[model samples]
Target: MKITRRIHSCVEISDGDTTVVLDPGGFGTPDNLAEVDAVLITHIHPDHVDADALTAARATNPELRIYGPEGLRELIDADYNVVADGDTFSLGSLNVEVRETPHEKIINSKELPENLGYLFNDTVLHPGDSMAAIPDMEVVLVPISGPWLRMLMVDEYLAAHRPKRFIGVHDGVDNDNGLTLRGGLLRQLAKDHGVEYLPLKPGESVEV
Candidate 1:
């Protein structure tokens, strides 16, 4: 499978024939939006679910399927499939398992939204905005920086899950310096836990 990292938490995964985009939000739309077969949303946050982009995509590709938690219906203006914990489905050759993880609490904010992690073909896990525990998977898309996150929390997450490999996501907030500092620390942390840390800049693609 080919994995392409987009800005913030957005990621595109393809198995040659089928292309699925996840979290095409405020950061940016997938480069191949017109060809996207499906879109999986982890939450309703604008940075993770760009309503304008999705609306345009839907207009352009009438067959494109969008899946997300139930609450997403109220936030989005376009039609989408509602999915909750334990749901399983397929997009061409890729099989997806939906696991609900509560959005991390942000101090002084209103109630948190529902977050769902997507496990792809039983190999990769995209845990959205949460660092919640999940079943064993070969690769994990870890959220490295955000308002509800800290270095210590990220360290704990890596130690707890210990996937064979991890790539940072939800990192649009960081400048080059901040990204370098965080990436350096995470690389060492992953090494300490016997996990390989693969860092990809926006628009970069890696095969797994």
Candidate 2:
């Protein structure tokens, strides 16, 4: 399988015959979805869901399938598959398991939106905006920076999963310097936990 990191929390995963994109939001626009089989959205946050871009993509490819929280249905006019916690489905060659990971509560926020993490083929876990850990994962997409994130929370999350390989995500808010500083610190911290941390810039891919 190949995992390509996009800006912010977006990731494209392809398993030879099928390609799936996750969280193509305002932080970054996904490439044309004409050949993409499915899209899994974790939440409805603007940074995680670009309504205009997705609308255009769907207009271009009406066969595209989109799945996410029930709240997402209200945002986009297209048909959708509302998935919650414990939903499992397959997108061509990709096996997916959905875990309802609550978005970390932001200080002074009235309410939090629904969030779900995707576990692909039971090997890779993408925890959208949460630090909620999944066990026995070989690879983990960890959020590095956001309003609800703290360094201690990140440390605890890494200790819990202890995945063999981890990649940082949800970092579009940072400038270049912040990316380098936070990513560097995260690399050393992950090493201390006996995990290999791979830093992927936007548009980079790594095979797993």
Candidate 3:
């Protein structure tokens, strides 16, 4: 599979026959959605779910399948599949398993019930904004930094999961403070854990 990092947590995964777009927000404009068969949204944050971009993509491709965590269905007008913890679904050749994420408790809003992480094709795991225990996968998309995710939690997640390859996401852009410190920390952690950690710049692609 070929993984293209658009920006932030947004990525496009193409396995020749099918293309799965994850977190099609932030740097994802309408033009970026071309030829996309499906979109998987991890959360409802604006940085992760730009309404205009998603709406345009859905409008352009009416057959597109949109998937998101629970409570997101009511927020979107498009035909969507709402998934919760332990839900399994498919998009063409890709099989996805949704895992529940603990709420960060930024506010007392009931709207933020649970977060989601996705195991795709059983080979890649995209842990939205949640810390995850490592599963058997060639590549793991790890959230190195975020408003709610702490540095220690990131360290623990990496050490625990220990995937063969790790790509730092949800940081290193847009003046996020953690990004500034995480680059060095991840490098050091990579050495300590004996895993390959890749810090990708925006608009870059990595093959897995």
Measured by TM-score, the strongest candidate is 2
Q: Any idea what lDDT model 3 has? A: 0.76
Model 3 alpha-carbon miss at residue 2, Å: 1.2
- Provide backbone clash counts, one per model: 1, 0, 1
Per-residue error for 26 in candidate 2, Å, reads: 0.6
lDDT of all predictions, in order shown? 0.88, 0.87, 0.76
Q: How well does candidate 2 score on lDDT at residue 108?
A: 73
TM-score of each: 0.96, 0.96, 0.87
Q: Candidate 2's residue-wise lDDT over 1-208, tens digit each? A: 8999987999999998899889998977777555588888999999998988887788889999999999998689898899989989998888999998778888774587899999999888888888878765788999989888887887887787788888899999999899878977898788878888888988899999
The residue pairs in collision within model 1 are 25-50
Model 2 weakest 10-residue run by lDDT: 27-36
Give every collision pair in model 3: 134-161
C-alpha root-mean-square deviation, each candidate: 1.2, 1.1, 2.4
Candidate 3, 125: how far from true, in Å?
A: 0.5
In candidate 3, what are the lDDT values of residues 1-208, reduced to their tens digit?
Answer: 8887777888788886888888866655435584688888888876677767787788878988888976676567787888888899877777889987775655565456457888888888887776676554678888766666676876777678778888888773447565666788889888888889877777777877
Model 2 regions more than 4 Å off: none
